[model samples]
Target: MCIFCKIAKKEIPAKLVLEDDDLVAFHDINAQAPIHVLVIPKQHITGIGEVTDEHVTVLGKLLVAARRIAEDAGLSQSGFRVVVNHGQHAGQTVHHLHVHVLGGRPLAWPPG
Candidate 1:
């Protein structure tokens, strides 16, 4: 199983922020911002490239969870960024589909 699948199955420990039947949000081990979190679906879907019609609901939930986590972390007023890296060239280290919630500081335009 992938690392994210292990996290969802409770086989690996993550700094959890939010969790539900279909999704899980946790702190990024390698944070880019003061408040950086990763929101992912429990069911592995590889990455955005693998998303299909059936993955729509879970994909939406990932955004919802990212928003909620940002708000709970007091980053809603300051603003936050939601990002998804689709492939290796996009800086996607993990194959699992996940959303990056970044905030607590100024983010530059045309982010990499």
Candidate 2:
């Protein structure tokens, strides 16, 4: 199984932040900022391009969900950023598609 699947199934340990039937969000073990959460779909998809039109609603839902989680995590008025890395060159370490919500400090432009 993929690393994310393992994390979801509890086969591996992760700093879980949220979960449900179709989605899951968690704190990255190695965070880039004070608040860095990774929200992912239950099914395995390597990138946004891999998501079918049937997934469009869920895709949008993930964004809304991320916002909700961000607010819940105390970033509502403070603002935050969402990111989806598509491929290896973009810094995607897991094969599963995920939305990264980051905030709690000033973010640099032209991300490194």
Compare the candidates by lDDT and give the number of the best one: 1
What is the per-residue lDDT of model 1 for residues 12-104, given as tens digits with 9 covering 90 to 100? 999998999999989999999999999999999999999999998998899889889889989978899999999989999989999999999
Name the regions of candidate 1 deviating beyond 4 angstroms: none
Estimate the lDDT of model 2. 0.87
Best by TM-score: 1
Residue-by-residue lDDT tens digits, candidate 2, 1-112:
7988887787888888888888888898879989999998877777886889889877987898899989998998888899999888888888888999999998899897
How far in Å is the alpha carbon of 56 misplaced in model 1? Answer: 1.2
Q: Look at candidate 1 and tell me the lDDT of residue 85.
A: 95
Instruction: Go through the candidates in order and give the clash count of each.
Output: 0, 0
On a 0 to 100 scale, what is the lDDT of residue 4 in model 1? 94
| Root-mean-square deviation of every model | 0.7, 1.2
TM-score of each: 0.97, 0.92
Candidate lDDT scores, in order, read 0.93, 0.87
- When summed lDDT is taken over every stretch of 10 residues in candidate 1, the lowest stretch is 59-68
